[model samples]
Target: MTSANPHRPIRGGAAPAAHATLPARGGVGLKPEHFRHILDTRPDIGFFEVHAENYMVAGGPFHHYLERIRADTPLSIHGVGLSIGGEGPLDEAHLDRLAALLARYRPESFSEHLAWSSHGGAFLNDLLPAPYHAGTLARVCAHIDRVQERLGRRMLLENPATYVEFEASTMAETDFISEVVGRTGCGLLLDVNNAYVACVNHGRDARAYLRALPLTAVGEIHLAGHAHDVDAAGAPLLIDSHGAPVAEAVWDLYAYAITLAGPQPTLIERDNDLPAFPVLAAEARQAEIVMARQAALEAA
Candidate 1:
């Protein structure tokens, strides 16, 4: 496990250009609806991202199209079911499958959420929240170490969009994540949309949350839409449902984060309400506009 200084100066010259590394300037999640457009048009996107679990099937059009897409543009593999925060040990079979995908695709970046998705051998298919206590932190660090060791690469851990806070939490979310980076040497996939959701749900200030974050550890950024739901008590609960275009508030938060992270890879994730490729591509273009404006400011 290793940790780097968050405030250290970037060694490269002016952040390596927008598309040199990841989120690529702006990218859209590789949805089945947009395969042809992506392949034929080859739109000016930074990269394409895919859920590693969705492509776990043996053979299908999905993998075939993905292969073609990968040949043209950079790609990122995001895992949603690794259950890295589970109380038990790392799942060897799952890791082997993930490693196989990495071997075949060789994506530019690979990431997973810091939350767990399983309990007592049952897969919940959702990123469940974990307590930010010492015991859970140690367990999560060990799991991350094993994951990085098995995959033979460092992974970016995304902050979970949590709806509930456990009484056992003894540290702030940012502190817990910073500690994880310290113990495991993994980078962060700072999802601005999640920060907005968490802030609204927990009645905290969004900008302050972002300000407290260790932006230097952030390797990528995720921008997605969320749904507002109310519980039995009629309290506001924001769900990380990537079913629509990013809201304006999220865009504002993204601007702030870009200032801190200095134009890292960013993705627009739309898993539901699957629209045409042009629609999603347009949203990606909006992200490009934002990035370009930010870069211009930096150059000035």
Candidate 2:
């Protein structure tokens, strides 16, 4: 018999704190703009994801609505400020707050980007890129270790959508992420939009990048939209702007990905130009349909 998820573990592994099993159906990023609609309607979403930084505060309407919504749905906490890929050591204070947040909410899954947004004791507002060399590799690995040890929970690392690549990068993005998984025993949150963006920007094969991922380590997937732009050479460049519906190429990449990895928890993220609930829900439904079709093919 074909397995439902090839990555499904057989024996003891990641604790519930690290990643509780999220339904493999589709979900959307929780936005404050849709808080009332979500609470009032209580849509049939697989789960809801939130930026951990948003809820790090002690209390307010955010937590007020979040706690209520969480009662009716699963929650996934995605961090944007841990700076796991930074050159400096991991922030003990941030990790402590993160741990406290995780304990308070007990989210089903937690993830962060592989890019660094902090440097020299200052936190930047963007998810900056990092070199994929041996030097950066050791630093990133240690940071991941610190996160897991302090939080006492497994975390998923996401791939970055890069507009530029470093000349010193000795390995491909896939290789760098694979090595991190091997060393840290952490999972991956495959971002299809990021893959498409990076491929288009670097002229790399998006499909090849997807196929090279360590499928068994993928705990979740993200789908979002990008903006059209031009590079210095007047070549087409895609910005990782999650302000609109996911593009067709990204959906195609997602279709191929589930075929290789099987049905996994997927989420639709929209941070800017926030649309109404139904709009994002429709995109997430498309993701569900694609996953269902792939599941049928695998079962056959």
Candidate 3:
């Protein structure tokens, strides 16, 4: 794939930024169970997000439904298996598959987590945390650059919802992600729920984290449910389970983030213990209400 300049034309004297426009309001994650309802009902959503790995296969019901749904709604390709922060070089075959999918689907945007999921050729099947050292930053930038080059599009990197902090960490999570965005010219998929979870686990301030985020680099936002766990030390750990409704506290964080980042294409991500379409739809509706309120506040 030919590499195009990631920079976009800027107004005034500011530098050009690589930002993708999400729907001004909100969206929901596309699940297999909700495909028919989404197609038939055509809920008032800004866009739909899908795990790229889930559709990486050749032929099946998933691809058929996704293609059909893509006709109406703007779609976002969110990858869970890219392992862009892993130790080894990016998986060439995986990148090829992703590129092929992009060519076929032509989603409005693409995104992946900032964490690693593979180690020494083994797939962990989970978004594992990565250190924030210079070496790791260089590796992640290289991988992101390769991914963007292969796909012929800029991608958004999400802040991971981590449970543990590595001793080798040399930078704050926000700083690390900001640096990656600076170096690779990729946008941010700001997961507000993850920011809240990390704040709880790491004893950081959620509002401060949101305030420090590179807002101009944010192209999308993620809101998901999480589970509480107890470590061996009897301490609380919040896991990005994505299995329930958005908690009240998370909603508060979302409101704060929208106040800063404005209303980007926000998504409600629920993956396990799946609820009825109406339940998730209701969540999306609630998000829309929040976005409206935020917009109203900004105007006022």
- Predict model 2's lDDT versus the native: 0.88
TM-score of 3: 0.93
Off by over 4 Å in 1: 1-20
Clashes of 3: 0
lDDT of 1 at 64: 96
lDDT of each: 0.84, 0.88, 0.85
Q: Which regions of candidate 2 are displaced past 4 Å?
A: 1-19
- Tell how far residue 70 is off in model 1, in angstroms: 0.4
Cα lDDT tens digits for candidate 2, 1-300: 112212222224344534567788899999999999998898999999999999999999999999999997888999999998898888889999899999988889889999999888888879999999989988887888778778776789999999999999999999999888877777899999999999999999999999888888888999999999999899999999998899998999999999888888899999999989999999889999999888788789
Ranking by TM-score: 2, 3, 1
Off by over 4 Å in 3: 1-20
Clashing pairs in 2: none
Candidate 3 residue lDDT tens string, 2-82: 134363322232522333445666688999999988878878788888999999888989999999988888889999998
